[model samples]
Target: MSGNRAAIRYAKAILQEANEANAGDIVFDDMRSVQATIRGSKELRVMLKSPVIKAEDKRQALLSIFGDQSKYTHSLINVLVGNKRIDMLSGVTESYISLYNEAKGIKEAIVTTAVALSSELEVQVLEKVKEITGSTNVTLKNDVDASIIGGFILRVGDLQYNASIANKLGNIKREFSKSL
Candidate 1:
């Protein structure tokens, strides 16, 4: 919980600072790159969590990877490293994205299905979701999950509509047990 709070705090601070400097959009892109890099690299994740490594070394490594970032992002890195909170950088980036999306009135959604969605189905899902949510700026992301067996689950913010086959099976199983 403390980690989440810290990430939110950092995100809010960065959002405010970047907006004041008229670089909110640029920093948003930078945050996306930062999040993508950290999420895709197992080595970087391991290195960030390793306590034996010096903070300065980690800071240098991050700067090199994200050297194209604006001065605002560089300052953010310095602040995190100085406070020994570099491991929370990814969380901070994600939180900042959420905040940015909110500021822009954009809604983000994740749809998990048994198989990859066809482009047509993806458009249909987005239309249905936007209609249901009454949101004009909805962004839908598709995630394939074979474990769900069939159907799809849609999640928008904290609200989830679970129409997946796995959930239905669990409900049926519960009913059968109750009958027994």
Candidate 2:
């Protein structure tokens, strides 16, 4: 939890700098790339979190991996390395993206279903999420979870609606046990 808070602080500072330089969009894309790169590579994640790796080494590795990034991104890397908080890079990127989206009045929604949603269904879900959040700009992410069996789970910010078949079955089982 404390780590997350620290990431948020770093992200806000970077966002402010990027906005002041009129490079918020560029920095936003760079952060997305950073998040995706770190998320995609297991070795990179391990290296970032490894106590044995020197902070300077980690900084150099990141710089080479993400060459040609915006000046703000390079500064963020330098700051994190100096503070010995490079391991929080992924968290910071995520927080930055979330903050950017929020500032742009864009909301992100996640829907977990047993199967991939069709284009028509995705459009419907986007409309529903927009209506619920009262935001015209909404991004929907679909996650497939077979364990749900059927139905879907929708999450928008702090609000979650679980309409999964597994949840209903669990509730029924609990009621049956109480009656017995």
- Each model's lDDT: 0.92, 0.92
Cα deviation of 44 in candidate 1 (Å)? 2.1
Summarize candidate 2's per-residue lDDT along 34-68 as a digit string, tens digits. Answer: 98899879999999999999999999999999878
Cα error, residue 118 of model 1, in Å, equals 3.7
User: Which lDDT tens digits does candidate 1 get at residues 122-144?
Assistant: 99999998998998799887888
Global local distance difference test of model 2:
0.92
- The parts of candidate 1 lying over 4 Å away from their true place are 1-3, 144-146
lDDT of 1: 0.92
Point out the worst 10-residue segment of candidate 2 by lDDT: 1-10
User: Which candidate leads the pack in TM-score?
Assistant: 1
